[model samples]
Structures are given as structure tokens and as C-alpha cells.
Target chain A: MKIAVDAMGGDFAPRAIVEGVLLAASELPSDAQIVLIGREDSIREIFKEHNFESSVVEVVHAEEVIEMGEHPTKALSQKPNSSIGVGFKLLKEKAIDIFCSAGNTGAMHVGALFSIKAIEGILRPAIAGYVPQLDGSIAIMLDIGANADCKPEVLAQFGEIGSLYAQYTFQIERPRVALMNIGEEEQKGSLVAQATYPHLKANKRIHFIGNIEGKDLFTNKADVIVTDGFTGNILFKLGESLYEITKQRGIQDDFIDKTNYESIGGSPIIGVNGNVMIAHGISSPTAIKNMIGWAYKQVQANAYLHIAQALA
Target chain B: MKIAVDAMGGDFAPRAIVEGVLLAASELPSDAQIVLIGREDSIREIFKEHNFESSVVEVVHAEEVIEMGEHPTKALSQKPNSSIGVGFKLLKEKAIDIFCSAGNTGAMHVGALFSIKAIEGILRPAIAGYVPQLDGSIAIMLDIGANADCKPEVLAQFGEIGSLYAQYTFQIERPRVALMNIGEEEQKGSLVAQATYPHLKANKRIHFIGNIEGKDLFTNKADVIVTDGFTGNILFKLGESLYEITKQRGIQDDFIDKTNYESIGGSPIIGVNGNVMIAHGISSPTAIKNMIGWAYKQVQANAYLHIAQALA
Candidate 1:
């Protein structure tokens, strides 16, 4: 299997990406191949310091880099030779099995949506992340900063996608899918949620588990929680901030500390046609390495195929 | 000043409400008075148990109660003699200086909107809460679960209300008001947020501090953070869950233990013409007592007058 890496994408690009690539290459199966996409000169310099074999890891030259601040669509169109653009192009052409980036998420999402495109029957792609709950359980929340304004139908689709992803990835059969709302009652919630609740209940594809409040998120009330991108993004950020604050508060608990961004590694962009992974822009060497490994596992599990089939 | 209490609203009911009313009557200045509204028999029985003789404490009879699960609007119309309905009516008639309830939030919001009415310049009433941050700071987040569908102008109004509330309640001058978005960039957020950004930036009423991500919520990045009701509710719930999870993990910090529903009292319903306090339905006796005291302070502070003046 071959994987494409956007070497020039994150805050600690090229160097960290190179180190992660080399680490992943060393530990990966003997038949695995890695392609690094970025500016050739910088990548070559980093590669020279490591003295790695050329057969296992190869570099593909790209002329430009998309800055984190650049507008995603304009940047991709203007800088087609950028590492992210080129890596996505490679994925579209099936040159690589998976495409990995720890770059600007907006740019990554835009690139994936227009390049790889959404899976058949999927309205919009969603980003799914595992949030550590109180009982050492993980809740899968989706559309964490994808499309902000979503219809009731879109949210129902998210429920289906989230349930399928949780079931396949976490190995939880009949994973409970709950819609996030202010209150647990079906009558409670915003207008969109009120409209979506009955639809989710009627759908046979997802295990609709009624409404789950944010307070139940940390508890094991549901395995997969679905929400619109606006709400999901807010919840994700709030959870992330809470973890950071608790860790910074000098509480030396291993469990809480282990749930940081580094521990979670990366989030998978579900509903895309191919396996696409997005890491935190500030990911370190260890995080990048884990993300690469995660991408490989997703490919091996054929998670994308299962998700497409479930949605279909 | 006279305060009206919904004696049969919360889980604790007449017992806690009666106790809170007596406590507030005893602790407040001699000029203060309390009117407990509920079924006369239950209110009288609760007051008899207290055996307190103060000219300040009185009971106003109401024949019905609104269940926690009942629809707010429908219940309000069907049960006009309910504790919440009668209390709000008393408030509307200028029979009480302030109205307090631990009833259903939707009922309180609906009752407050129609009965107490919105402030002159306010477009819609917003529910605001203080989210405790890491550095001994608090970020005031608004519209936690009020309006589901929101306009850009409504979000801008929330920013103004939140900023003013933070300034008056938390004593933060020149409070930074941030629009919650997926990213700090101006271009990143839902369409509503995007449209509101320029408006918030141009408005002189608030110290508009650009966009803040969910991760920035607990980092002291902004004193007042504004978002639509849907996203804000999700963020608030996530924060509440994190706080709960952190406490469960045995991180018994004073703030966490104190502020959990058991402590820190209730949330003041802002944007109303008068001071209307809403406590958690599952509030403890101590929380109920504290909420009464909080209501008394707001009445004394003339919170509504200050908010009106500031908005003006």
C-alpha cells in the first residue's frame, strides 16, 4: 500500500513530517511504500539528515506552499502545485491509498470536498473525532466544523454516518446514536432538532437512542452523538479547551492528561470517497507518527468502504 | 421591594422555595418583602413548618402547577393559575418587583418573553451563563438554549447583552466580546456568524474582539463570548459536562465542587424588562436559598435599569 504525506503542511512541517514519515516507514509492513509531497529541496535536506533508504520513502516535488491563513478555495486554485493540492490530486488519481495532512483544516476540508469528492449518497462530508468520556469510554461526534448551517435531513445523515463510523472503527455493534440537544426530551431542542428527531427514530440504518444532552456527553449514555457542524464544532472546542484547562490546572491525573490532542492523534474525515486524515496543526512528531499509523489502519480496515456501504 | 417566588416549580418544591423565601426575608434589608406563589394549602403548610414571623414573607395562592415535561407555551395557556403563570402575571401587574422560578426553562423563557416582556431595544431575550475558566476567570456565554434559529443581528445583540452583563456583574470594564466560530479568522464560521462579524466589528456598543474558537473559551481570551442559541447551548452543555467529568475524576477543586448545580446558585434571565431569575429544576435546598439571595441582590442593584441604561 502507498500513502501520500503533505510534508509542508503543519506548524512543524517538513521536519516533523519527515521524522514521522521515517518512523512510520521503519515500523510499517515491509511491502508498504511512502510518498512525501512538498518542496523538493527542503524535503531533501531533511531526508539527508536521516540517511534513510530511497526505496522505502520517496519525495515528490511541489513548487508552492499553502499558508494556514490563505483562503482554502482561492489558495488551492492559485497554488495547484502546493503540497496539499498535489497530495490530494495523487489520491484522486489513486496514486496513493490514503492522503494525510496536519495543515489548515479549512483548506484540507475544501480540498477533500472538491478533489476526492463526497461518497455516493452523501450530502456533505463530516469530520469525526473521539472524545474521552468519564468511564474511559469514547464518544464519536461528527461534523465537527464542516458545514455550519445544516438542515434536519443533513443532521439525520450525520447520525447515520456517525453510528456507522463508531460501529466499524470502535467495534461497537449496534452503537447508540443520539442527537445532541439542550434537553433529553424529544420535544426539546431547536427547530431543526425537533424536526430531525422523528426521522432519526424512524430510520432503520442508525440505532436512534433519543435525545442526549451535553451533560450526558461525558457519561456513557450514547456511543455516537450526532449534531450539526455549528453545534458539533462548539462542543468539540469546548471539550478540547476543558481538557487543556484541566491539564494546565496542575492536576496530575494520568487519565485526564492522556486525553490531550497528542493522545487522540488525528481525526478522520468521514464520507469522503477515499481515506483522508487531518491532524491538529500543532501536532508534534509523536502525534504525526500516530496519525500516519491511524491512516494506515483506516485503510487496512476498509473503514471508508464500510461507511459508504452503510450510507448507501 | 417585593419578590415573587414560584413556590411549586422545582423538584424541591414548596419546601425549598418556602425555605429560600424565609431565608431571603430574614437576611435582606427590612424594606424587602417576599411573596410565595403556589397552591395556598401547600404554601401555608411549608410556611407553618418554618414557624417564621416576619412582615416581609407572604403567600399568594395559585391553584395549579406546570410539570417539568409540559410544553411551555401550551402549558402556560392551559394552566394560567400555575405557579409560574401566576408569578409572571404578578410581575406583569407590578404586584412584585422581581419574579423567581426553578421551573422549566422553556416555560420561564416563554413566560418571561410574553409576561415581563423584552427590553425596549432588545430583539429577543437571551439566556446567559457564566462558564468558569482555568485562570480563575469566567467567560459569560449567552443564548445557551433560547432561540434555535438566529439572525446575524440577534447574535450581535447577544454580544451587546453579554458584554453589558459581564461589565455590570463581573465588573470587567472594556470587556472583550468575541463571536464564537470554528476558527479565529474572519472568514471562518456559519453564514450567520460571517454576516454578523462585520456588524459586531462596526458596533461601538460592544468592545468587539474578533472571533474566538471553542478552545479559546476557557483561556481568558474574551470576557464575553457570543454565539447563536444552538451553538451556544451545545458549548455550554459541553462545558457543563467537562466540569462534571473533571469532578468525577476526583479533581475536587473548590471552584468545580462549589459551582456544580449544588452551588453557584442560578442563572439570571437577562434582556427582560424586570429582574427574572431561573434556577435549575433539580436545584438543592442550598442552591434554592442562594438563588433567592441572588434575586434579591439583582432587585436591589436595579440590574434591569442598569442594563437598559447601558443599552440605551
Candidate 2:
């Protein structure tokens, strides 16, 4: 199986990406290979500087580069040879088992939708964030920043799809799904949240655990936390910021350490046709390496296929 | 100044409330007095149990109690002699300097509206939460859990009223007001949030700062953080939970310690005609004591009068 890395992505692209790929190469199984997609010369230069040589890592040249600030749909069409563009092409063709990037989040999201596309019967594909739990486990929170304004039906669908992803990927049978809201009551929340609660409760595919308040975020209350992209994105980022806030104060704890973005590295765009993970824009070498590890696990889980099958 | 509290409110009512009042009575200024509103016998019994005696503490009898789960409007009308009802009556008649409760949040909000009513020109009154800042100061976040779904106008007004409250109550001149959003960009949020941006920016009364994400919650980015009640309530509760999660893990930090709900105690309802504050239903004696302290500060600040003057 081939795992593609966008070498010309993120703030410290090429160097950080290449160095991270090299780090991941050492842990990869014999059946797996890392495909570095970018300008071949730049990737080789980084490898040479690190005094690194690996038979498991291969470079695929892409002439054009999509800058971090470029518009998603426009850049994908205009710069077809861009690293992100080519990476999606390879993913669509199944040349790579999974595609991971720390590039422009919008471009990556747009590229995935335009390439492999959303799975059949999917209303809207969502970005799923990994929330570290107090019990050393992780919960999957969907629509992190994908659809900022989702309807009630859309949010309810997230609960269903997110449950499937968590069950198959994380191996949690009948994963407990909860709606992220202001209160624990079904009737308490914004109009959209209030309306979505019943839909989630009515769904028989997953274990609906009712509403989970903000205080229950890291308490291992549920396996899948579903919300619209707007609230989910803010909460996810806030959760990630805890690691930096605590670290700056010279405070250390086992659970707090996992809050670091580098621990999980990437958030998968679930409900899509194939495996696609998007990392932080400021992702470091360690973060990239960790992302690749998760990428390998996602490839193994084949959650997208399960979602498609369930929907079908 | 006379500060009134609902002794029959909260999970540990009468006992915790009376004990807390005694705690505050010792520290209150000579001119200030504590008016305990509930069954006079129950309060005196707790005061007797604690071996506490103070000239500053007085008791007022209210025959009925508003349970935590009771409907706000229904309970207030049916139980006219309830603690919350008597407290609001005292506040309306100017018999008390300020009224605070840890009971039925909805009743307190509804009572304030029905009694003192909202300040003239105010579309809606909001519950303002005190967010602990990294710099050891506090930022005022409005609409914590008052109106779940706020229109753009209501949210924009929160920014203005919140700014005024922060400036006068916190004694900050020209407080920086910011919109709480998913992203830092103006156009990047839900439909209501996007529409509210331009309104906040155009308001001449506030020192409007751009968007502040959830990560910026305690970063001292702004003095007044504005958002709809749904998002604001969840974020506030989430921020408060950090203290407990960290404490359970035996992690200690000066900054994280401030995240404790007991640190400040109560969240004040802004845009109301009178000074009204509410605490957690599970408030302990320490929390009640601290809330009384803030109640004293609120009376001194006279923030409600200032907001009324500004709108006029």
C-alpha cells in the first residue's frame, strides 16, 4: 500500500514534510511505502541534508505549488500540477492508499470533494477531530470545520456517520454518539441543536447517548460527539490550545500532554469516498510523522468503505 | 447597602447559603448588610449549628422554594411567595442593593425580566460570565445562557452592553470588545455570526476588535467577548471545567487554578434594569461566599445604572 504526503504543503513544507516522511519510514511495515509528492529536487535536498537514505520512501515530482493562502477551488483548477492537485489525482486513481497534507485546509477539503467525492447517500462530508479523553482514550468529533452552517438533518447525519467511523476505525462496538450542546437535556440548546436531538435519538444505527455538555468534553462520556462545523471547530481548536497554554506555564501531566496537536497530527475528512487527512497549517516534523502513522491506521480501518456499505 | 440571597436555592440550600452569608458577613464593610431570603427558621438553625453570630446578617421569610427543574414562568407566577419571587420583589422596590441566587437559572432570568425589566432600548438581557485571563485579570463574556438563539441585532447589542458593563463594572476604560467566532476572519462563521460582525464593527460605542476564537478565550485578547447564548454558555462551562479536570489529575498551575467556578462565584445578568447574578446549582459555601463578594462589587460598580444611562 502507498501513503502519499504533500511535501510542498504547510508553513515549513518540503523540509519539515520530507524530514517527517523519513522519520515515519523507519516505523512503516514492509508492505507499506511513503510517496512524497512535490518538487523532487527539494525533497532530495532535504534528505541529503539530513544524511538520510531510505528505500521505503519515494519522491514524485509536481511542478507547481499551491501556496497556503490560495483559494481552494480556483487554485485546484488553475494549478493542476500543484502538489495538492497531483496528490488528489493520485488518490482518485487509487495510486495511494491514503493522502495526507498539512497544506491549505480549504484546498485539501475542496480537492477531496472534487476528486474522490463524497460517498453515496452522504448529505455533507465532515472533518472529524480527535478529542483526547481523561481515561487515555480518544473521541471522534465530527464537522470540525467542514460545514460551518449545517441544517438539523445534516448534524443528525453526522451522528450516524461519526458512529460508524468510530466503531470501525477505533474498534468501538456500537460507539456511543452524543450531540454537543449547551445542556444535557434534549429540549435545551439552540433551535438547530434542539431540533437535531430527536433525529439523533431516532436513528437506530448507533448508540445515541443524548446530549453532552461542554464539561463532559474530556470525560470519556461518548465515543462520537456530533455538532455543526461552527461550534465543533471552535471547541476543537480550544481543546488543542490547552497543551500550549499548560506547556508555557511549565505545567506537565500525562493527559495534558496528549492535548498537543502533534499527538494525533491530523483530522480525517470522514464521509468522503477515500482516506484523506488534513493537518495543522503550522505542523512540525513530529506532527507530520504522527499524521502519517494515523494515515497508516486509517488505511487499515477502511472506515470510508464501511460507511459507504452501511449507507448503500 | 443590602445584598439579598436566596437561602433556599442551590443543591445545598439553607445550610450552605446561611453558612456562606456568615462567611461574607465577617468580611463585608460596615455599611453593607446581608439579607438572607428563605425560611427564617432553617437559616437561623444553620447559623446556630455553625456557632455564627453577626449584626450584619438578617433574615427574611419566603414560604416557597423554586426547585431546580421547575418551569421558570410557571413557578414564578404560581409561587408568588417563593425565594426567587421575594428576591426579585425586593430588587424591584429598591429594598435591596442587589439580588443573587444559585437556584432555577431560568426563574432568575425570567424574574429579572418581569420585575425590574430590561434596560430601555435593550433587545435582550444577557448573562455575562467572568472569564479568567492568563494575565490574572478577567474578561466579561456575554450571553452565557440567556437566549439560546439570538438574532444579529441581539448579539451586536451584547457587544455594546458588554463593553459598557466591563468598562464601568471592571473599571476598564475603553474595553476592547470582540466577537467570539470559529475563525479570526470577519466573514468566517455561522450566518448570524457573519451578519453580526458588520454591526459590531460599525458600533461607535465600543472599541471593537476583530474575531477571537475559542483558543483566545483566556489569552486577554479582549475585555468583552460577545456571542450568542448557545455558544457562549458551552464555552463558559467548558472553560470552567478545565480546573476540575486538572485538579482530578493532581496537576497544579496558578492559571488553571483560576478556572475554578468558585474563584469568581457568580455570573451577572447584563442589560437588565437591576443588578442580578446567578451561581451554579451545586454551589458550595465557598462559592456562595465568593459570589456575595462579587455582588458587593457589582453594587458598588452600579453597572446597570451606567448601561441605562448609555442607552438613554
TM-score of chain A of each: 0.92, 0.99
**In DockQ, how does model 2 score against the reference complex?**
0.83
- For residue A293, give model 1's deviation from the true position in Å: 3.0
Local accuracy of candidate 1 as per-residue lDDT tens digits, A93-211: 99998888888788899999989899999988888877777677788888787778788888888888878777777778899999988777788788889999998999998889999
Summarize candidate 2's per-residue lDDT along B118-213 as a digit string, tens digits. 999999999999999999989999899998899999999999999888888889999999998988888889999999999999999899998999
Evaluate model 1: give its TM-score.
Answer: 0.91
Model 2 misplacement above 4 A = none
Candidate 1 residue lDDT tens string, B1-312: 887788888888878878777766767777778888898888777667878766787888899999888889999999999999998898988889888888888899999988988999998888887777656776778887788778999888888887877777677878999998987779778888899999899999889989988788777789988887777777776665555676666777755554365454677777998888888787666777777776766776665677788777
Please give the lDDT score at residue A187 for candidate 2: 94
Leading candidate by lDDT: 2
Native contact fraction, candidates in order: 0.79, 0.75
- Cα TM-score per model: 0.91, 0.99
Q: Give candidate 1's whole-model lDDT.
A: 0.81
**Model 2 lDDT tens row, A179-241:** 999888889999999999999989988899999988888999999999888888888888998
Go through the candidates in order and give each one's C-alpha lDDT: 0.81, 0.92
